[model samples]
Target: MNYQLSLTVAICFGLLVLLGYFLPDFDLLILLRAEILRWAAILSGVAMFVGIISLLKVHFNKFMDQKSNWGYSLVLVLTFLITFGAGVFSFIFPQAEGLVDFMFRYVQVPVESTLAALLAVLLLVAGMRMVRYRRDWTTWLFLAISLIMLIGLVTIEAPIPDVFPFLRDWLLTVPVVAGARGILIGLALGAIITGLRIFTGADQPYGE
Candidate 1:
């Protein structure tokens, strides 16, 4: 019975998806496409909720055992609960409460910014150490680019000749932006393919 139901649903979905592409003249196909997208969003939200539940469970266990770094888990749980409560109350009240917004703006933002700054420092230190150890052309190139980027971002005015700021702008706009965009596109495509594969029963992670 389960097999038959699954097969039927798959067949129907495939036919509707194909129809939307093949018969671009039909308005009903467009509606079907929208419906498909709506359901996809709903399912994705549910999946995200499931993931959060799993993460909370793991962290709660760690906290209960008083594991090393359990303080971080405590912070995580506290933050999650506070944010959840704020969201629920915000929904009920419909007015932006000062305390909730303050917590979100001051507490959350500073913590996030501090963490980001720490990571950036760690990355820079690691890169410097690598350059010290390897002293290869690749490491040299990485250090050069990183330093140029840091300088460009920090300096109010370009240190180089007027033409050099233009050059730096070009390098940042062209290569840096293009590489970042390409990586993002590749990651998004990979995620979509993996999701579809799982949905189609081609990749099973649950050992079914």
Candidate 2:
């Protein structure tokens, strides 16, 4: 039954996409695409309730089984409940903007900023390691260009040659960006193929 449903949906979607691409004048196809997305978002939101239950079950199990980081599990549960409570309170008392705004600013902003900073530092370290540890001319060339660009970006009047900025712009706007975009396009194509395979039952998220 699942297979049949999947196959039917896949064929219908495949036909819609093909037809949309072929007949670009009519926007009924585009509307259909948007409608699918709208329904998908609604269904996905509904599915999150099941996800929440599953998450609680797993984390509670970890705490019950006395896992190594049970304290972390307890903290997670506490934070989840507190945030949920705040949301419910906000819904109940829509006029109480102070409490909700304070929690949003104090609790969420700092955590998000800290995570972003950590990610930036990690990326910087990875880039440095690649430049420092690699034993190749291409890597050295990349590192040299990166250093020049960074310096040029930081110091507006650093007495660098006029060509440095030009070279940096070229490196960024021409080769590096083009190569990254090409890779992204390839990755998107691969992902689409994989998703189509899954939709057609050639690949399954769950084991057969």
Candidate 3:
């Protein structure tokens, strides 16, 4: 009985939202949709805050307990505190904007750049390992494509023919765009399927 009521409520709200989107002439639906969406946004923000607090608590406990690798957790806690403190100060006193910007540039930017570099290095190492073990055309092709892309990224003119640069541009513009669109299409289809499942009661959320 409770499950049926929950399913009925879900279907009603789902229809209200879909109708509000498709039929903007219905003022009541538009208002209901706006209120529902606003509540969702508020809930999302609260959830995010809870998650951050939970993360800090976990790391603080790990550090205080003096577990293995506690030093890393200590570093993380200190970094978070410093960053958060700086952000709060900057927000309270607009004159301290420079302090926030400095931390972002010196700390965050370098960390992100290092991660990106590690990703490239890891990918190269993985490709080499695959080629060594497999010794197949596909592995060789993968390595060749990676090399060509890296060479294309260089601003300096290489000793090789001009065709490499053209090939790189074509690959970026054509295959990359096509692949990105395909991923978006897949995501949209998945979302649609999920909505249908919810509406049809195939996926029950409020069940005990």
Q: For residues 30-119, could you state the per-residue lDDT of candidate 3 as single tens digits? A: 999998889879989999989989998999999999989999999989998998999999999999989989998998899999998899
**Cα lDDT of model 2 by residue, 1-208, tens digit:** 7767766777687667666778877799977766776887898998998899788888888988999999888888888888788888888998864776788899899989999889978988998898677879988887788787976576655777778778888888998899999999999999989977866667656532
lDDT of 1 by residue, 1-208 (tens): 6665665566577678768988989999978977987897999999999999999998999999999999999988988998889878877887766658888789879988999889978987898799779987988887777666656566665455554456678888998899999999999999989867756766545531
Kindly report which residue stretches of model 1 are placed more than 4 angstroms away from their true locations once superposed. Answer: 1-24, 92-100, 147-207
Tell me the lDDT of candidate 3: 0.89
Q: Worst ten-residue run, lDDT, model 3?
A: 152-161
Please tell me which model should have the higher TM-score, number 2 or number 3.
Answer: 2
Residue 74, model 3: Cα distance from true site in angstroms? 2.0
Candidate 1 positional error at 156, Å: 5.7
lDDT for model 2 = 0.81
List candidate 3 segments past 4 Å from native. 1-9, 83-106, 132-137, 150-155, 169-184, 205-207
RMSD of each: 4.4, 3.2, 3.6
Candidate No. with top lDDT = 3
**Cα lDDT for residue 17, candidate 3:** 83
